[model samples]
Target: MSINHTLKTQPVTPAHVQQEVKLAQRNLANSTPKENTTPEKGTDVKLSALTQHIKADSPRDIDMERVEKIKDAIRNGELKMDYDKIAQALLQNILDDR
Candidate 1:
């Protein structure tokens, strides 16, 4: 037995191209700027207390000693990782964000 299938597709015409262009223009004009974009002048900014504290208390330098200790632990097979628990926590974090 033999089976055959045919599919029909529309060719892009000038009219379709013009319509798509207009649609893209309209979408661009209607879209709002993202929050991470620089704010306009005179815009008031506020940070939460936790954010302010984090900004103030954040260390400027990396803790090389801690990093080396972790690296040594991993090399020596002394680093115990609860991978299942870590994976669960990561999955929970992702789901919570959604």
Candidate 2:
């Protein structure tokens, strides 16, 4: 026994597409250039009270030694990770967000 199949396809019309492409090209050609609005040197800028407070309250001290020790431990494969605690913390954060 032999089986045969036939597929039908519609012809595409480029006239509509050509018109859209021409319109886009004309629009792009006629578009105006944007003006630069950058602030000049010696411009006085003011920050909000909340922003000032946050900046003042932020910590300036960073323990680079501790950071380097942790990085070294990870590189030496000597870092012990509590996966259960991390997972619990992550799940708690998601629940809190919801």
Candidate 3:
């Protein structure tokens, strides 16, 4: 899980670290930049001719059941999940149950 960085050789100087930080920030910025338009616009522009609506729900009841379990865990203190952890766990639970 360890990732290589500029620090693999000499200790990172302020300039080197700053450059790395900027590059990383740029990468993060690029990753989440807003799409120019919604998918609904694609067909109208002929950029894409076809589309399918995604069903945004699990196929199994177990997903919802797991959510109830996790919510109960939080409410009853069987587990304490932070905001990020709770969101992650919510996704994981859906996948797990699915």
Candidate 4:
């Protein structure tokens, strides 16, 4: 048994939608891709200077000489432990957290 029903046909796209599609295509066709250029030496220098500042903010570069000196001091028993100063700093940090 089959029930008869009329197939409804609606508009694929409204007039405004078709107009917007055309406008978007026109915009895309008119726009040009930006040209890529090789940076000059001055630009590279500026970028390098900017990177140096960024590196200074980050502790990525370790002072090997100073690190070795500290290691030697520790090995020679020349490194002194400041318990009071360390405790004071820790207490100050804890209080500052509040």
- Per-model clash counts, in order, read 0, 0, 0, 0
Highest lDDT against the true fold, candidate: 1
Clashing pairs in 3: none
Candidate 4, poorest ten consecutive residues by summed lDDT: 37-46
Instruction: Give lDDT tens digits, candidate 2, residues 43-81.
Output: 688999988887785445568788999999999999999
Query: Cα lDDT of all candidates, in order?
Result: 0.87, 0.86, 0.74, 0.85
Q: Tell me the lDDT of candidate 3.
A: 0.74
Tens-place lDDT digits, model 4, residues 1-98: 44686678986898899999999999997796657956666543445776778767555577888999999999999999999999999999999999
Structure candidate 1, residue pairs in collision: none
Question: Which lDDT tens digits does candidate 3 get at residues 1-98?
Answer: 54654454675578888999999999999899696856654444423333322333447736888898999998998986479988998999999997
TM-score of 4: 0.39
Instruction: Give the Cα error of residue 55 in candidate 2, in Å.
Output: 4.5
In model 4, the runs with Cα more than 4 Å from the true position are 1-60
Q: What is the lDDT of residue 86 in candidate 3?
A: 83
For model 2, how big is the CA root-mean-square deviation?
10.0
